[model samples]
Target: MNENLRCADEARTASVVELAQELIRRPSRGGIDPYGPVLGVLEEWLDARELPHRRLRDAAGAPVGLLVEVPGGRPGPWWTLDACLDTAPYGDETAWTFPPACGDVADGRLRGRGAADSKLAAAMFCHIAADLAPRAHELAGGLAVLLDVDEHTGGFGGARAYLADPHAARPAGVMIGYPGIDEVVVGGRGLWRATITVHAPSGHSGSRSTTVGAVTRGAHLVRLLDAADLPGGDDGSGFPLPPKLTVTAFHGGQGFSATPDRVDIHVDIRTTPGFDAHAAETLVREAVTALDTALPAPLPTAVTPVAAWPPFRLAEDAQPAAALLGAAAKAGLTVRAKTAGPSNIGNLLAGEGIPATAGFGVPYEGLHGIDERAHLAELPQVYAVYQRAVLELLGR
Candidate 1:
C-alpha cells in the first residue's frame, strides 16, 4: 500500500475498533433499539464530513435504511456498499472470555459480539466513505452506503421493504461487507425456514396403538428426512448450480408423563442458484406424507413455508467482481469465489440485477458464537484492499 493509503488505514484502525465497541455496547439484538445508537453515530459522522445522505423510514417512522451518497462527476453505473446493522443476540455473557461489548483488543484480536460478524464491515464501510469523499468528484459512478436494520432475524423485512418502496435508491452494483478474509465471495446460498406440524388425537400413555401420538409421528418424519438426500455441489463454485439443504432445528413432544398431542419440526433449507422453492417444498412435503403413511393411524400433518429467501450469485466477470479481484491481487492475495451458508443482503441486490458479492472485511473465527473476534492486525491491510476496490469500481 502507498504511504498515504497506509497512513489513512492506520488512522481508521482505531476508529474501526471504537465503532465496533460502540455498536456492541448497545446490545442491538434483532430489534429497533439495538440499531438506533449506531445509526446515530453514523449519521453524526456523515454530517461532520458534509456527505449527502438520506434516512429511509418505515411506516412507523423508525429508521430502517441509512442511505449515504457520494455523487460522482459524471453519471454512470451507481455502486452501493451495504452492511447489515442488526446482530445475533449475545448469549451467556459468562461463556465469553471477555465482556460482550467491551471491544477488548488483545493478542492481535478484537473480541465482542457483532465485532466480526458484521459490525466490523459497517465500520469499515464508514471509513471507506470518509476516505473517498474528498476524491468523489474524480469518480465516474455514484457511491452509496446502505445500512440495513434487520439481518440476523432475516434481511427481507429491511431489504424487501427497501425494494418495495418506489422512492428507494437503486445502484448499479452493490458490495456487501460480509466476513471474508481477502477472498472474493461471488455467491451465497438461499435459505428457507419451514415448519412441519404433526397432529394426532390425544390418548392416555397406557394406550399403545389405540391412538397415534403426534410426537411418535414427528419422530418418524424426522428419520425419513434424515435419510433423504438434499441437493448440494462443490463448495466454491459460482452460480447457476444445484443448491444445498440441511435440517438445522427440530422440536417436538411435551413430557414423558403424557403423550404430546401436537409436534412441530423446524427446518432450515439452503438452496443453490437454480433451485426452485416450490419444488423443494414439494419434495419435503412428499417425504412427510410418506412418513405419515407408515404410522398405524395416519396423523394429520402440514408442511408450511415459514420464510423463504432466494440464493444469489454474481457473474465472475462482472465489473464489481473483477474490481474486487483486482483489489485482492493488488493487496498481494489471490481471489477465490465461494458460497456462504448464511444468507445476506447480497441476495436482494443480486436479485435486482446488481452485481453484488459478500466478503470484504478482516478475517476472524467464531462468528455468531461465543468468543467472536476479528484479527486486529489484518484490519489495516483489509481496509486498504477494500479502499482500492472501491476506487477501482468508482473509476477514481
Candidate 2:
C-alpha cells in the first residue's frame, strides 16, 4: 500500500478499536432478536458518515441484518465482506479473569466476549467501507459489507435474509471475517446440531431397584455416544482436521430431590463432506434405540432436528481465495489455506454457489469461553488484509 493509504489506515485504527469495544459492550446473544440494540452502533456510524445502507427485518420487525455498499472507482465484479453482530454466549462468568462484557483493553488485547469471535472484524469492515467510499470510482464493481445478526445460532437465517434481498445483486463472491488470521480457511467440516430428548419414566432417587433415572440415562447415552466408534470417513483426507462429534449440552433433572422426568441433550456433529446429517441422525436414533432396549434403562427417546449445515469447500484456484492470498502476500503476511473447526456463514454462501466463500479474520483467544479477547494491536493489519482483499476482488 502507498504511504497515503498507510497513514489513512493508521488514523482510523483508534476509531476501529473504539467501535469494536462499543460493540462488545452490547450483549447480542443467540436468539431471534439478536441485533436489537447492538446494530444501533453500526447504524449510528453509517448515519454519521452519511453512508447509504439498509436495515433488514424479520416478520416481527426485528433488525436481522445490515447491508452497506461502497461503489468502486471503476467497474469490476461485485463482492461482499461478511461479519456478524452476534457472539457466542459468555459461559460461566465466574471463570473469566476479567468481566466478559466490559470491553477493556489490557496487555495489547481487547478483553470481551465478541471481540475475537467477530466484533473486531465487524468494526474493521466499517472502516474499510469508509476508506473505500471516497475512491469508489477508482475501483471496479462495488463492495458490500454485510454485518449480520444471526450467525452464532447457525448462519442460516441471516444468510437467507441477505440472499432473498431483491435490490442487492447476489455477490459474485464472499469473504467471511472470522478467526485464523494466519490461515485462509478453504473449507470446514459439515455440522449438525440437534436436540435429543429422552422420555424416561420418573423414578425416586430413593429407589433400591438399581434402575438409573432420567438424568442417569442421559449421562449413559452421552457416554455411549462419546465412546462409540461411529462410521463416516473424512472427506478431505489431505486436510489436517477430521470429522468430530460431541455432546455440547446436557440438561436434565428438575430438582435435587425428585427423579428427573426428562432430559434434553444437544449434540453437535462436525464432519468433512463425507458425513450426511440425515445419516448421522439415523445413526443417533439407532444408537439410542439400541441402548434403550439392551440396557433396560430409558423407556423412550425422541430426536428433534435443530440445524444442519453441509461442509463448505472453495476450489483451490478460486478468484476470491487468490485475491485474499495475494492481498496477504502484498501485506507481507504469510498465510496458507486450511480448514477451521467452527462453521460460519460460508456454508450457506458456498451452498448458494458463491465460488470463493471463505473465512479470514484476526487471531484471538478463548473463543466461546471465559476471558475471550481480540488482539488489539492487530486491528490495523486486519484492516490491511481486508483492504487488499477488496482491492484484489473488485479492482477494475
Error of 1 at 213 (Å): 0.7
- Residue-level error in angstroms, candidate 1, position 35: 2.4
lDDT of 1: 0.75
* 1-396: candidate 2 lDDT, tens digit per residue: 699977876779888988989998988877734476788988999999977788876666767789898877665678988888888887898988988889889999988988887888888888888888888878889898888887787644566787888888788888888876788887776777789987666777777756667787788889888876655444444544566789999888875667887889999887565566876787688778876886564357888888887777776578788888877888888888876677767766766877554666777899888888888666677678778878777763
Candidate 1 lDDT, 1-396, residue by residue in tens:
699976865777988888777776766777635467777877887788898876777777776767777878876777878887777777787888888777777888878878887788888888788878887888887787777777777644566556666765577777788776756778777777788888877766876756768877777888877787765655354454555556666676666667777888887777765565775787788887797677744445888898776787776778788888778788787768776666766766666766678886788877888888888777877778778888878776
The clash count for each model shown is: 2, 13
- Any runs in candidate 1 off by more than 4 Å, and if so which? 1-9, 231-243, 273-275, 296-299
Those runs of model 2 whose alpha carbons end farther than 4 Å from true positions after fitting are: 1-6, 27-36, 72-76, 90-107, 203-220, 231-240, 255-261, 295-300, 355-358
Error of 1 at 313 (Å): 2.5
Give the whole-model CA lDDT for all candidates, comma-separated: 0.75, 0.79
Model 2, position 80, has a per-residue lDDT of 87
lDDT of 2: 0.79
